[model samples]
Target: MKISPKARMNRLFTNGGCLDVAIDHGVCNEPSFMVGLEDMPRVVDSLIRAKPDAIQMAYGQADLLQSRPEKDKPALVMRLDMGNPYNATRHRTMWSMLQNADEPIIGALEMDAACVVVNLFMLPDEPEMFRQCVENISRVRADCHRYGMPLMIEPLVMLSNEIRGGYQVDGDADKIVTLVRLAAEMGADIIKADPTANPEDFHRVVEAARVPVLVRGGGKEDLKTVLMKSAALMAHGAKGMVYGRNIYQHANPGAVVRALMSMIHDGADGEAAWQVYNRG
Candidate 1:
Protein backbone atom coordinates (compact mmCIF):
# COMPACT_ATOMS: atom_id res chain seq x y z
CA MET A 1 0.00 0.00 0.00
CA LYS A 2 1.43 3.33 -1.04
CA ILE A 3 1.37 5.90 1.68
CA SER A 4 -0.31 9.13 0.57
CA PRO A 5 1.22 12.50 1.28
CA LYS A 6 -1.08 12.76 4.28
CA ALA A 7 -0.06 9.31 5.37
CA ARG A 8 3.57 10.19 4.80
CA MET A 9 2.96 13.17 7.01
CA ASN A 10 1.47 10.76 9.49
CA ARG A 11 4.60 8.62 9.37
CA LEU A 12 6.77 11.63 9.89
CA PHE A 13 4.60 12.97 12.68
CA THR A 14 4.09 9.70 14.53
CA ASN A 15 7.37 7.91 13.83
CA GLY A 16 8.99 11.12 14.86
CA GLY A 17 6.78 11.08 17.93
CA CYS A 18 4.77 8.21 19.40
CA LEU A 19 1.31 8.31 17.81
CA ASP A 20 -1.18 9.43 20.41
CA VAL A 21 -4.89 9.48 21.37
CA ALA A 22 -7.00 6.66 20.04
CA ILE A 23 -10.56 7.41 21.21
CA ASP A 24 -12.21 4.23 20.00
CA HIS A 25 -13.10 2.91 23.44
CA GLY A 26 -16.87 3.33 23.01
CA VAL A 27 -16.77 0.86 20.15
CA CYS A 28 -14.53 -1.53 22.09
CA ASN A 29 -17.08 -2.34 24.83
CA GLU A 30 -15.59 -0.13 27.47
CA PRO A 31 -18.83 0.68 29.23
CA SER A 32 -17.18 2.68 31.95
CA PHE A 33 -14.08 4.01 30.29
CA MET A 34 -12.26 6.72 32.19
CA VAL A 35 -12.86 8.79 29.09
CA GLY A 36 -16.51 8.98 28.05
CA LEU A 37 -18.85 10.99 25.81
CA GLU A 38 -18.82 13.97 28.13
CA ASP A 39 -15.08 13.67 28.35
CA MET A 40 -14.64 13.95 24.58
CA PRO A 41 -14.68 17.72 24.30
CA ARG A 42 -12.02 18.39 26.91
CA VAL A 43 -9.88 15.45 25.96
CA VAL A 44 -10.11 16.28 22.30
CA ASP A 45 -9.23 19.88 22.99
CA SER A 46 -6.22 18.95 25.07
CA LEU A 47 -5.04 16.38 22.56
CA ILE A 48 -5.43 18.85 19.75
CA ARG A 49 -3.19 21.26 21.61
CA ALA A 50 -0.81 18.50 22.57
CA LYS A 51 -0.61 17.65 18.85
CA PRO A 52 -0.64 13.93 18.37
CA ASP A 53 0.10 12.59 14.90
CA ALA A 54 -3.37 11.10 14.56
CA ILE A 55 -6.50 10.33 16.53
CA GLN A 56 -8.35 7.04 16.01
CA MET A 57 -12.02 6.97 16.90
CA ALA A 58 -15.25 5.40 15.70
CA TYR A 59 -17.21 7.06 12.91
CA GLY A 60 -19.44 8.94 15.35
CA GLN A 61 -16.46 10.29 17.23
CA ALA A 62 -14.72 11.20 14.01
CA ASP A 63 -17.79 13.13 12.99
CA LEU A 64 -17.63 14.93 16.31
CA LEU A 65 -14.03 15.87 15.67
CA GLN A 66 -14.85 17.06 12.19
CA SER A 67 -17.33 19.45 13.72
CA ARG A 68 -14.62 21.00 15.81
CA PRO A 69 -12.56 23.98 14.64
CA GLU A 70 -9.33 22.88 13.02
CA LYS A 71 -7.03 25.42 14.55
CA ASP A 72 -4.46 22.96 15.88
CA LYS A 73 -5.96 19.51 15.60
CA PRO A 74 -4.11 16.44 14.36
CA ALA A 75 -4.99 14.08 11.52
CA LEU A 76 -7.80 11.54 12.04
CA VAL A 77 -8.41 7.87 11.32
CA MET A 78 -11.91 6.44 11.71
CA ARG A 79 -12.14 2.93 13.12
CA LEU A 80 -14.91 1.62 10.94
CA ASP A 81 -16.39 -1.21 13.04
CA MET A 82 -17.52 -2.11 16.51
CA GLY A 83 -17.24 -5.58 17.99
CA ASN A 84 -20.18 -7.96 18.05
CA PRO A 85 -22.44 -7.46 21.03
CA TYR A 86 -21.88 -11.12 21.77
CA ASN A 87 -18.26 -10.28 22.54
CA ALA A 88 -19.35 -8.87 25.86
CA THR A 89 -21.96 -11.55 26.55
CA ARG A 90 -20.01 -14.74 25.77
CA HIS A 91 -16.61 -13.60 24.54
CA ARG A 92 -17.18 -15.91 21.62
CA THR A 93 -16.31 -15.76 17.96
CA MET A 94 -18.27 -12.66 17.06
CA TRP A 95 -18.86 -10.33 14.13
CA SER A 96 -18.47 -6.59 14.26
CA MET A 97 -21.17 -4.03 13.48
CA LEU A 98 -19.67 -3.05 10.14
CA GLN A 99 -19.83 -6.57 8.74
CA ASN A 100 -21.99 -5.11 5.99
CA ALA A 101 -19.07 -3.09 4.52
CA ASP A 102 -20.85 -0.11 2.86
CA GLU A 103 -21.56 1.66 6.12
CA PRO A 104 -17.90 2.13 6.99
CA ILE A 105 -16.97 3.35 3.53
CA ILE A 106 -19.62 6.01 3.70
CA GLY A 107 -18.60 6.88 7.24
CA ALA A 108 -14.98 7.35 6.21
CA LEU A 109 -15.97 9.69 3.40
CA GLU A 110 -18.30 11.66 5.61
CA MET A 111 -15.63 12.06 8.24
CA ASP A 112 -13.03 13.09 5.64
CA ALA A 113 -10.43 10.87 7.24
CA ALA A 114 -7.05 9.88 5.87
CA CYS A 115 -7.59 6.18 6.57
CA VAL A 116 -9.81 3.53 8.15
CA VAL A 117 -8.67 0.80 10.53
CA VAL A 118 -10.27 -2.64 10.66
CA ASN A 119 -9.34 -5.20 13.29
CA LEU A 120 -9.43 -8.90 12.45
CA PHE A 121 -9.76 -11.08 15.52
CA MET A 122 -8.64 -14.70 15.31
CA LEU A 123 -10.08 -16.64 18.17
CA PRO A 124 -10.56 -20.32 19.01
CA ASP A 125 -14.34 -20.39 18.73
CA GLU A 126 -14.88 -18.64 15.42
CA PRO A 127 -12.42 -19.58 12.73
CA GLU A 128 -14.91 -18.97 9.93
CA MET A 129 -15.55 -15.44 11.12
CA PHE A 130 -11.90 -14.73 10.56
CA ARG A 131 -12.14 -15.83 6.94
CA GLN A 132 -15.32 -13.85 6.41
CA CYS A 133 -13.72 -10.84 8.04
CA VAL A 134 -10.69 -11.05 5.80
CA GLU A 135 -12.96 -11.18 2.78
CA ASN A 136 -15.00 -8.21 3.95
CA ILE A 137 -11.83 -6.33 4.78
CA SER A 138 -10.56 -6.88 1.25
CA ARG A 139 -13.76 -5.46 -0.18
CA VAL A 140 -13.81 -2.51 2.20
CA ARG A 141 -10.16 -1.79 1.56
CA ALA A 142 -10.79 -1.65 -2.16
CA ASP A 143 -13.64 0.74 -1.51
CA CYS A 144 -11.34 2.85 0.63
CA HIS A 145 -8.90 2.96 -2.24
CA ARG A 146 -11.60 4.21 -4.62
CA TYR A 147 -11.99 7.22 -2.38
CA GLY A 148 -8.19 7.54 -1.95
CA MET A 149 -8.39 6.74 1.75
CA PRO A 150 -6.04 4.00 2.84
CA LEU A 151 -7.27 1.19 5.07
CA MET A 152 -5.17 0.25 8.08
CA ILE A 153 -5.62 -3.10 9.78
CA GLU A 154 -4.83 -4.31 13.26
CA PRO A 155 -4.96 -8.09 13.34
CA LEU A 156 -5.57 -9.40 16.85
CA VAL A 157 -4.92 -12.99 17.91
CA MET A 158 -5.65 -12.69 21.57
CA LEU A 159 -3.84 -14.65 24.33
CA SER A 160 -6.80 -15.37 26.61
CA ASN A 161 -5.40 -13.65 29.67
CA GLU A 162 -7.27 -11.70 32.34
CA ILE A 163 -6.26 -8.12 33.06
CA ARG A 164 -8.45 -6.68 35.75
CA GLY A 165 -11.99 -7.64 34.70
CA GLY A 166 -11.21 -7.59 30.99
CA TYR A 167 -9.53 -10.06 28.66
CA GLN A 168 -6.01 -9.40 27.43
CA VAL A 169 -4.16 -11.25 24.70
CA ASP A 170 -0.48 -11.91 24.49
CA GLY A 171 1.15 -11.24 21.14
CA ASP A 172 2.06 -14.16 18.90
CA ALA A 173 4.78 -13.00 16.51
CA ASP A 174 4.05 -15.58 13.87
CA LYS A 175 0.35 -14.98 14.01
CA ILE A 176 0.75 -11.23 13.63
CA VAL A 177 3.23 -11.66 10.81
CA THR A 178 0.76 -13.83 8.98
CA LEU A 179 -2.00 -11.34 9.59
CA VAL A 180 0.12 -8.53 8.18
CA ARG A 181 0.91 -10.55 5.10
CA LEU A 182 -2.77 -11.29 4.55
CA ALA A 183 -3.67 -7.64 5.03
CA ALA A 184 -1.05 -6.59 2.51
CA GLU A 185 -2.27 -9.15 0.00
CA MET A 186 -5.83 -7.96 0.60
CA GLY A 187 -4.75 -4.29 0.29
CA ALA A 188 -3.93 -2.61 3.58
CA ASP A 189 -1.87 0.58 3.76
CA ILE A 190 -0.75 0.28 7.36
CA ILE A 191 -1.05 -2.11 10.30
CA LYS A 192 -1.11 -1.77 14.08
CA ALA A 193 -0.31 -4.85 16.15
CA ASP A 194 1.39 -5.95 19.34
CA PRO A 195 5.05 -6.90 19.17
CA THR A 196 5.74 -10.53 19.89
CA ALA A 197 6.94 -10.92 23.50
CA ASN A 198 10.30 -12.09 22.24
CA PRO A 199 12.54 -9.38 20.79
CA GLU A 200 14.04 -11.51 18.03
CA ASP A 201 10.65 -12.92 17.14
CA PHE A 202 9.14 -9.44 17.12
CA HIS A 203 11.87 -8.25 14.77
CA ARG A 204 11.06 -11.13 12.46
CA VAL A 205 7.43 -10.09 12.47
CA VAL A 206 8.40 -6.54 11.55
CA GLU A 207 10.72 -7.65 8.78
CA ALA A 208 8.19 -10.10 7.43
CA ALA A 209 5.45 -7.47 7.46
CA ARG A 210 7.35 -5.39 4.87
CA VAL A 211 4.61 -2.78 5.27
CA PRO A 212 4.92 -0.21 8.04
CA VAL A 213 3.94 -1.56 11.48
CA LEU A 214 2.74 0.25 14.58
CA VAL A 215 2.42 -1.21 18.07
CA ARG A 216 -0.95 -1.19 19.80
CA GLY A 217 -1.32 0.03 23.40
CA GLY A 218 -3.26 -2.02 25.99
CA GLY A 219 -1.29 -2.72 29.14
CA LYS A 220 -1.04 -0.82 32.43
CA GLU A 221 2.73 -0.83 32.60
CA ASP A 222 4.44 2.29 33.88
CA LEU A 223 5.94 4.93 31.56
CA LYS A 224 9.44 3.52 31.67
CA THR A 225 8.21 0.11 30.68
CA VAL A 226 6.15 1.56 27.84
CA LEU A 227 9.07 3.63 26.55
CA MET A 228 11.44 0.72 26.75
CA LYS A 229 9.09 -1.52 24.83
CA SER A 230 8.43 1.17 22.24
CA ALA A 231 12.12 1.85 21.80
CA ALA A 232 12.89 -1.80 21.47
CA LEU A 233 10.23 -2.16 18.79
CA MET A 234 11.56 0.88 16.93
CA ALA A 235 15.06 -0.48 17.13
CA HIS A 236 13.75 -3.58 15.43
CA GLY A 237 12.58 -1.28 12.58
CA ALA A 238 8.93 -1.05 13.55
CA LYS A 239 7.40 2.15 12.18
CA GLY A 240 5.88 3.76 15.28
CA MET A 241 3.42 3.39 18.15
CA VAL A 242 -0.39 3.59 17.91
CA TYR A 243 -1.24 4.10 21.54
CA GLY A 244 -4.29 5.10 23.56
CA ARG A 245 -4.80 3.89 27.11
CA ASN A 246 -1.19 4.61 27.96
CA ILE A 247 -1.59 8.25 27.10
CA TYR A 248 -5.13 8.94 28.25
CA GLN A 249 -4.97 6.78 31.35
CA HIS A 250 -1.78 8.35 32.59
CA ALA A 251 -2.11 11.13 35.14
CA ASN A 252 -0.07 13.42 32.88
CA PRO A 253 -1.18 12.82 29.33
CA GLY A 254 0.82 15.72 27.90
CA ALA A 255 4.03 14.66 29.57
CA VAL A 256 3.61 11.11 28.37
CA VAL A 257 2.93 12.20 24.82
CA ARG A 258 5.99 14.44 24.85
CA ALA A 259 8.17 11.64 26.17
CA LEU A 260 6.98 9.27 23.48
CA MET A 261 7.49 11.91 20.81
CA SER A 262 11.07 12.36 21.85
CA MET A 263 11.86 8.70 21.43
CA ILE A 264 9.79 8.14 18.30
CA HIS A 265 10.76 11.25 16.32
CA ASP A 266 13.84 12.72 17.90
CA GLY A 267 15.59 9.41 18.39
CA ALA A 268 16.04 10.01 22.08
CA ASP A 269 17.38 7.16 24.15
CA GLY A 270 15.10 5.25 26.50
CA GLU A 271 16.59 6.84 29.62
CA ALA A 272 16.01 10.34 28.30
CA ALA A 273 12.59 9.53 26.96
CA TRP A 274 11.69 8.02 30.32
CA GLN A 275 12.02 11.51 31.78
CA VAL A 276 8.80 12.53 30.07
CA TYR A 277 7.03 9.95 32.18
CA ASN A 278 9.06 10.76 35.27
CA ARG A 279 8.21 14.45 35.04
CA GLY A 280 4.60 13.44 34.76
Candidate 2:
Protein backbone atom coordinates (compact mmCIF):
# COMPACT_ATOMS: atom_id res chain seq x y z
CA MET A 1 0.00 0.00 0.00
CA LYS A 2 1.18 3.51 -0.74
CA ILE A 3 1.99 5.78 2.21
CA SER A 4 -0.68 8.16 0.98
CA PRO A 5 -0.71 10.37 4.03
CA LYS A 6 2.97 11.15 3.54
CA ALA A 7 2.72 11.49 -0.25
CA ARG A 8 -0.29 13.80 0.04
CA MET A 9 1.64 16.06 2.37
CA ASN A 10 3.39 17.33 -0.76
CA ARG A 11 0.47 19.73 -1.08
CA LEU A 12 2.08 21.72 1.71
CA PHE A 13 5.27 22.31 -0.28
CA THR A 14 5.88 24.14 -3.49
CA ASN A 15 6.87 22.18 -6.59
CA GLY A 16 10.45 22.33 -5.31
CA GLY A 17 12.12 21.46 -1.98
CA CYS A 18 10.52 22.29 1.38
CA LEU A 19 11.17 25.29 3.65
CA ASP A 20 9.93 24.37 7.10
CA VAL A 21 9.88 26.67 10.13
CA ALA A 22 10.27 25.05 13.53
CA ILE A 23 8.70 27.02 16.36
CA ASP A 24 8.94 24.20 18.87
CA HIS A 25 11.99 25.50 20.77
CA GLY A 26 10.31 27.30 23.64
CA VAL A 27 8.79 24.19 25.14
CA CYS A 28 12.13 22.40 25.41
CA ASN A 29 14.37 25.31 26.35
CA GLU A 30 14.11 28.60 28.13
CA PRO A 31 13.35 31.59 25.86
CA SER A 32 16.78 33.25 26.25
CA PHE A 33 18.11 32.44 22.77
CA MET A 34 14.78 32.83 21.04
CA VAL A 35 14.79 36.60 20.64
CA GLY A 36 11.53 37.06 18.75
CA LEU A 37 9.74 33.86 19.79
CA GLU A 38 9.12 35.01 23.35
CA ASP A 39 6.19 36.88 21.82
CA MET A 40 4.65 33.70 20.48
CA PRO A 41 1.66 35.15 18.65
CA ARG A 42 3.68 37.88 16.97
CA VAL A 43 6.41 35.51 15.84
CA VAL A 44 3.78 33.07 14.60
CA ASP A 45 2.18 35.89 12.67
CA SER A 46 5.52 36.79 11.12
CA LEU A 47 6.27 33.21 10.14
CA ILE A 48 2.78 32.75 8.70
CA ARG A 49 3.15 35.91 6.64
CA ALA A 50 6.45 34.62 5.21
CA LYS A 51 4.64 31.48 4.02
CA PRO A 52 6.86 28.57 4.93
CA ASP A 53 5.90 25.25 3.33
CA ALA A 54 5.39 23.71 6.79
CA ILE A 55 5.84 24.50 10.47
CA GLN A 56 6.76 22.52 13.59
CA MET A 57 5.27 23.70 16.89
CA ALA A 58 4.86 22.32 20.38
CA TYR A 59 1.73 20.45 21.55
CA GLY A 60 0.87 23.37 23.82
CA GLN A 61 0.54 25.72 20.85
CA ALA A 62 -2.61 24.08 19.52
CA ASP A 63 -4.80 27.06 20.33
CA LEU A 64 -2.42 29.47 18.61
CA LEU A 65 -2.23 27.14 15.65
CA GLN A 66 -6.00 27.04 15.36
CA SER A 67 -6.24 30.79 15.56
CA ARG A 68 -4.18 31.41 12.43
CA PRO A 69 -6.31 33.41 9.96
CA GLU A 70 -5.12 31.67 6.83
CA LYS A 71 -7.28 28.84 5.58
CA ASP A 72 -4.26 27.52 3.68
CA LYS A 73 -1.75 27.80 6.45
CA PRO A 74 1.34 25.62 6.11
CA ALA A 75 1.28 21.99 7.12
CA LEU A 76 1.52 21.33 10.84
CA VAL A 77 4.23 18.99 12.20
CA MET A 78 3.05 18.47 15.77
CA ARG A 79 5.86 17.79 18.26
CA LEU A 80 4.86 14.71 20.24
CA ASP A 81 7.65 14.83 22.84
CA MET A 82 9.26 17.15 25.40
CA GLY A 83 12.66 17.16 27.07
CA ASN A 84 13.43 16.32 30.69
CA PRO A 85 16.93 16.82 32.12
CA TYR A 86 17.00 13.33 33.56
CA ASN A 87 16.47 11.61 30.22
CA ALA A 88 20.04 12.01 29.05
CA THR A 89 23.44 11.12 30.49
CA ARG A 90 24.28 14.79 30.17
CA HIS A 91 21.47 16.55 32.00
CA ARG A 92 21.09 19.19 29.28
CA THR A 93 20.55 16.86 26.30
CA MET A 94 17.24 15.39 27.47
CA TRP A 95 14.65 14.76 24.77
CA SER A 96 11.84 12.52 25.90
CA MET A 97 8.06 12.36 25.71
CA LEU A 98 5.97 14.86 27.66
CA GLN A 99 3.29 12.34 28.56
CA ASN A 100 2.54 9.21 26.58
CA ALA A 101 4.17 9.65 23.16
CA ASP A 102 0.80 9.01 21.53
CA GLU A 103 -1.04 11.82 23.27
CA PRO A 104 0.17 14.63 21.02
CA ILE A 105 -0.60 12.64 17.90
CA ILE A 106 -4.15 12.07 19.10
CA GLY A 107 -4.65 15.78 19.75
CA ALA A 108 -2.97 16.67 16.48
CA LEU A 109 -5.34 14.39 14.58
CA GLU A 110 -8.22 16.43 15.93
CA MET A 111 -6.63 19.58 14.50
CA ASP A 112 -6.20 18.09 11.00
CA ALA A 113 -2.44 17.80 11.37
CA ALA A 114 -0.19 16.68 8.53
CA CYS A 115 2.52 14.90 10.55
CA VAL A 116 3.71 13.98 14.05
CA VAL A 117 7.35 14.25 15.23
CA VAL A 118 9.42 12.94 18.14
CA ASN A 119 13.08 13.46 19.11
CA LEU A 120 15.52 10.66 19.91
CA PHE A 121 19.10 10.51 21.08
CA MET A 122 21.00 7.50 19.77
CA LEU A 123 23.10 6.41 22.73
CA PRO A 124 24.69 3.03 22.12
CA ASP A 125 26.19 2.72 25.60
CA GLU A 126 23.03 3.45 27.54
CA PRO A 127 20.70 0.55 27.01
CA GLU A 128 17.86 2.19 28.91
CA MET A 129 18.06 5.38 26.84
CA PHE A 130 18.31 3.37 23.65
CA ARG A 131 15.34 1.26 24.65
CA GLN A 132 13.28 4.32 25.52
CA CYS A 133 14.03 5.85 22.15
CA VAL A 134 13.14 2.67 20.34
CA GLU A 135 9.96 2.22 22.36
CA ASN A 136 8.83 5.80 21.67
CA ILE A 137 9.36 5.53 17.94
CA SER A 138 7.76 2.09 17.76
CA ARG A 139 4.69 3.26 19.65
CA VAL A 140 4.32 6.44 17.60
CA ARG A 141 4.77 4.53 14.36
CA ALA A 142 1.77 2.35 15.22
CA ASP A 143 -0.26 5.35 16.29
CA CYS A 144 0.42 7.16 13.01
CA HIS A 145 -0.75 4.20 10.96
CA ARG A 146 -3.91 3.76 13.00
CA TYR A 147 -4.68 7.45 12.66
CA GLY A 148 -3.51 7.65 9.01
CA MET A 149 -0.97 10.36 9.83
CA PRO A 150 2.66 10.64 8.75
CA LEU A 151 5.39 10.28 11.38
CA MET A 152 8.76 12.10 11.54
CA ILE A 153 11.64 10.91 13.71
CA GLU A 154 14.41 13.35 14.65
CA PRO A 155 17.52 11.53 15.85
CA LEU A 156 20.68 13.02 17.32
CA VAL A 157 23.97 11.41 18.30
CA MET A 158 25.74 13.24 21.01
CA LEU A 159 28.74 12.95 23.36
CA SER A 160 28.73 13.40 27.14
CA ASN A 161 29.74 17.04 27.36
CA GLU A 162 26.34 18.47 26.36
CA ILE A 163 28.17 20.94 24.19
CA ARG A 164 25.84 22.49 21.61
CA GLY A 165 28.41 22.39 18.81
CA GLY A 166 29.83 18.99 19.60
CA TYR A 167 27.69 16.94 17.22
CA GLN A 168 29.09 18.73 14.17
CA VAL A 169 32.51 17.12 14.56
CA ASP A 170 34.30 14.87 12.04
CA GLY A 171 32.78 11.59 13.17
CA ASP A 172 29.25 12.96 13.20
CA ALA A 173 28.65 11.95 9.59
CA ASP A 174 28.85 8.22 10.19
CA LYS A 175 26.98 8.46 13.47
CA ILE A 176 24.17 10.32 11.73
CA VAL A 177 24.13 7.64 9.07
CA THR A 178 23.59 5.10 11.81
CA LEU A 179 20.84 7.19 13.35
CA VAL A 180 19.08 7.58 9.98
CA ARG A 181 19.13 3.88 9.28
CA LEU A 182 17.94 3.19 12.81
CA ALA A 183 15.01 5.58 12.46
CA ALA A 184 14.07 3.99 9.16
CA GLU A 185 14.23 0.52 10.68
CA MET A 186 11.92 1.78 13.43
CA GLY A 187 9.39 2.86 10.76
CA ALA A 188 9.68 6.62 10.39
CA ASP A 189 8.04 8.13 7.33
CA ILE A 190 10.40 11.11 7.63
CA ILE A 191 13.59 11.77 9.59
CA LYS A 192 15.16 15.04 10.71
CA ALA A 193 18.84 15.36 11.60
CA ASP A 194 21.71 17.77 11.84
CA PRO A 195 23.67 18.45 8.63
CA THR A 196 27.24 17.25 8.70
CA ALA A 197 29.81 20.00 8.16
CA ASN A 198 31.09 18.29 5.03
CA PRO A 199 28.19 18.86 2.62
CA GLU A 200 28.77 15.69 0.59
CA ASP A 201 28.65 13.54 3.74
CA PHE A 202 25.02 14.49 4.14
CA HIS A 203 24.25 12.24 1.20
CA ARG A 204 25.37 9.29 3.34
CA VAL A 205 22.64 10.22 5.76
CA VAL A 206 20.02 10.54 2.97
CA GLU A 207 21.07 7.32 1.25
CA ALA A 208 21.20 5.37 4.50
CA ALA A 209 17.73 6.36 5.65
CA ARG A 210 16.12 5.95 2.21
CA VAL A 211 13.45 8.33 3.47
CA PRO A 212 12.92 12.05 3.20
CA VAL A 213 15.65 13.72 5.30
CA LEU A 214 15.39 17.31 6.46
CA VAL A 215 18.37 18.84 8.31
CA ARG A 216 17.63 20.46 11.64
CA GLY A 217 18.58 24.12 12.15
CA GLY A 218 20.73 23.82 15.25
CA GLY A 219 22.00 26.89 17.12
CA LYS A 220 22.01 30.42 15.70
CA GLU A 221 24.17 30.34 12.62
CA ASP A 222 24.50 33.46 10.47
CA LEU A 223 21.78 33.85 7.83
CA LYS A 224 24.21 33.86 4.95
CA THR A 225 26.03 30.79 6.22
CA VAL A 226 22.82 28.83 6.80
CA LEU A 227 21.46 29.74 3.37
CA MET A 228 24.76 28.78 1.72
CA LYS A 229 24.83 25.48 3.58
CA SER A 230 21.18 24.83 2.71
CA ALA A 231 22.04 25.13 -0.98
CA ALA A 232 24.82 22.61 -0.54
CA LEU A 233 22.48 20.30 1.37
CA MET A 234 19.82 20.37 -1.36
CA ALA A 235 22.47 19.77 -4.01
CA HIS A 236 23.55 16.71 -2.05
CA GLY A 237 20.01 15.22 -1.81
CA ALA A 238 18.62 16.62 1.42
CA LYS A 239 14.86 17.19 1.34
CA GLY A 240 15.31 20.58 3.05
CA MET A 241 15.78 22.10 6.50
CA VAL A 242 13.81 22.88 9.68
CA TYR A 243 14.85 26.22 11.11
CA GLY A 244 13.90 27.94 14.39
CA ARG A 245 16.43 30.54 15.49
CA ASN A 246 17.86 31.41 12.06
CA ILE A 247 14.54 32.72 10.85
CA TYR A 248 12.89 33.96 14.05
CA GLN A 249 15.94 35.75 15.43
CA HIS A 250 16.52 37.90 12.36
CA ALA A 251 15.66 41.60 12.33
CA ASN A 252 13.16 40.98 9.55
CA PRO A 253 11.81 37.48 10.07
CA GLY A 254 9.44 37.62 7.12
CA ALA A 255 12.27 38.66 4.84
CA VAL A 256 14.55 35.95 6.19
CA VAL A 257 11.85 33.32 5.76
CA ARG A 258 11.19 34.53 2.23
CA ALA A 259 14.92 34.40 1.43
CA LEU A 260 15.09 30.80 2.66
CA MET A 261 11.94 29.91 0.70
CA SER A 262 13.54 31.31 -2.41
CA MET A 263 16.65 29.23 -1.80
CA ILE A 264 14.76 26.06 -0.94
CA HIS A 265 11.88 26.28 -3.44
CA ASP A 266 13.39 28.43 -6.15
CA GLY A 267 16.95 27.08 -5.90
CA ALA A 268 18.49 30.49 -5.39
CA ASP A 269 22.17 30.40 -4.48
CA GLY A 270 23.46 32.01 -1.32
CA GLU A 271 24.30 35.28 -3.02
CA ALA A 272 20.87 35.45 -4.60
CA ALA A 273 19.22 34.62 -1.28
CA TRP A 274 21.32 37.29 0.39
CA GLN A 275 20.13 39.76 -2.22
CA VAL A 276 16.53 38.77 -1.50
CA TYR A 277 17.12 39.25 2.22
CA ASN A 278 18.95 42.53 1.65
CA ARG A 279 16.27 43.85 -0.67
CA GLY A 280 13.93 43.98 2.27
Best by TM-score: 2
TM-score of each: 0.86, 0.89
lDDT of 1 by residue, 1-280 (tens): 5324355335335434437468787776655455534477777777777777778887766766778878556777778776752232445455654634655578767767766788777755667668767766877776776666767787776643232234355576777788777767776667777777875677776666666777887755777888888888888877778888788777778788788777777887788898766776
Give the residue spans of candidate 2 off by over 4 A: 1-3, 31-34, 85-89, 92-95, 101-104, 123-125, 162-171
Q: Which stretches of candidate 1 lie over 4 Å from their true place?
A: 1-20, 32-38, 85-89, 161-166
- Cα lDDT of model 2 by residue, 144-197, tens digit: 777778888988775544543233222378888888888888888778887886
In candidate 1 the C-alpha lDDT for residue 123 amounts to: 59
| Candidate 1 lDDT | 0.70
- Clash pairs, candidate 2, are none
lDDT of 1 at 267: 85
